[model samples]
Target: MESLVVPVLILLAVVAGVTVAYRAARKRKTGRPASQAEPAKAPQELARAAADRLSEDEHRRVYALIAQGQAMAAIKLYYEITGEGLRASRDAVGALAAHPQPFRRQEPAQAVEEDDDEPQRFPYRYRAIASKGDVTREVSSNMLNDEIYGRIRTLARSGDTEAAANALTRHSDISLTQAREFIALLDD
Candidate 1:
């Protein structure tokens, strides 16, 4: 009888511990303090707005981690670079991978600060390619640099295919139909 009583007490203790743990988890998920919860981020139209957010070296390192399938490391790098909440960092890294943005060398502060409506000419022509299986399409233009191309890709990824196609047409001499086709490939 003594042995049975000891076993019963142990079982009760285990049950109590499980109950406490379950309640704690529930509280964290449903009733967490406002300070402990991450604030929701605004949905930006263009993910390219983050191009200048991370330096070239960090961008390259994160891309390398992504290529090697170390997603968690890439997310950690993004979190460190942007100082964003963990969930936001995860989403940013995922968007980067899905959209495949290129690292742009940082421009001079003066050049960036001068926000004129005129398009700045790049020293070298830029080339962007999208392929699905045997169908490959390439867009080469002096005006279509990494930032613009990244914005175009972001538009395509966000389901604004027509806007992306229009942006491509405006940037390049390609016809609307051709731009649509290229945008379609990017969406794929």
Candidate 2:
């Protein structure tokens, strides 16, 4: 019992000493001298450049997408193509689709001219809600662009003319007349 008591006390003393030393070392490493501290920049000044580069609407959109936890790769690709970052673009898209009152509404459609002179076309938002039997599918503009073109060509080659025409009309931003003309050309 005496031998065990001494060994236990010695072990406790050693542990306490090591703990004190470790804590003291950590404090010494972390505690910077007053002269060594770096000066802080103003938050407004720090954010100014990023703010200037992106509009308020863009910022809101990006932050909202980020909040929604979108994949970084998809966001990066979107940002690369569009000037807006992934988060912002996602937020903007969501706002456009879901919000009752949008912060920025798209401009009115311009008159189509016969001549070569054409105004910039604003990105269109398309949502197709289709129900077949019990299954309902909601297709968005982005999904249509990504998958419809190839599907349309395949369907057309397979002699599924109706399906191809429907797919082309659903995918394209052009009028039904224009889509029909294009699909007719596919036959030729």
Candidate 3:
């Protein structure tokens, strides 16, 4: 009985040590230092430069697709026209949707023209991902953007989880149940 007690105590200690190590590993993997954090708002300069690469026709076509809520098609068109990689095309389209630009004709002799500011629609879906520890969540919807997602994150971090979940469900196609589940996984 004495020998068994020592072995059981050693086994319990090992198990506790392993559990602590696993939790620490998860925390390290999920936590980001201040310097490594991504900017909430994407840089607009990249979008402006990418807008110059599209011709008048392509520009109109991409915007029309965006207006029609065809994000994947718009991304495919941008990739085909620019010969850029898939990720670059996706980023450029996201930027363009966020900040609309007028079509620019490639003719050197012709001057650029500005379109009316009639609130162009970019009704394309965006995917926002949140992860902490071993849990990961993704929200896909047309109503989400950097600003709205940032607000949601702020709400989640501030412990207003119900408000965040409600706002998420209101803005996204997700159900209230799903929104709550997603919100619960956010880093508090």
lDDT of each: 0.80, 0.53, 0.82
Q: Which pairs of residues collide in candidate 1?
A: none
Candidate 2 per-residue lDDT over residues 41-160, each given as its tens digit = 344443343334445576565446556665354355336646776666444344433432323444559965522122232276545443445545444454254344556657767888
What lDDT does model 3 reach?
A: 0.82
Which pairs of residues collide in model 3?
none
Give, for candidate 3, the lowest lDDT window spanning 10 residues.
Answer: 112-121
> After aligning candidate 1 to the native by TM-score, how far in Å is the CA of 103 from where it should be?
38
Q: What is candidate 3's CA lDDT for residue 168?
A: 86
List, residue by residue over 1-188, the lDDT tens digit for candidate 3. Answer: 89899999999999999988887776677695434655644548767867899988889999999899999999999999999999889999989998998876666866535222221224787898877788888998877777778888899999999999988887787899999989988875
* lDDT accuracy of residue 76 in candidate 1: 95
In order of appearance, the predictions have TM-scores of: 0.38, 0.28, 0.36
Worst 10 residues of 1 by lDDT: 40-49
Q: How accurate is candidate 2 locally (lDDT)?
A: 0.53
Each model's total of backbone clashes: 0, 3, 0
| Candidate order (lDDT) | 3, 1, 2
The full ranking of all candidates by TM-score, starting with the best, is: 1, 3, 2
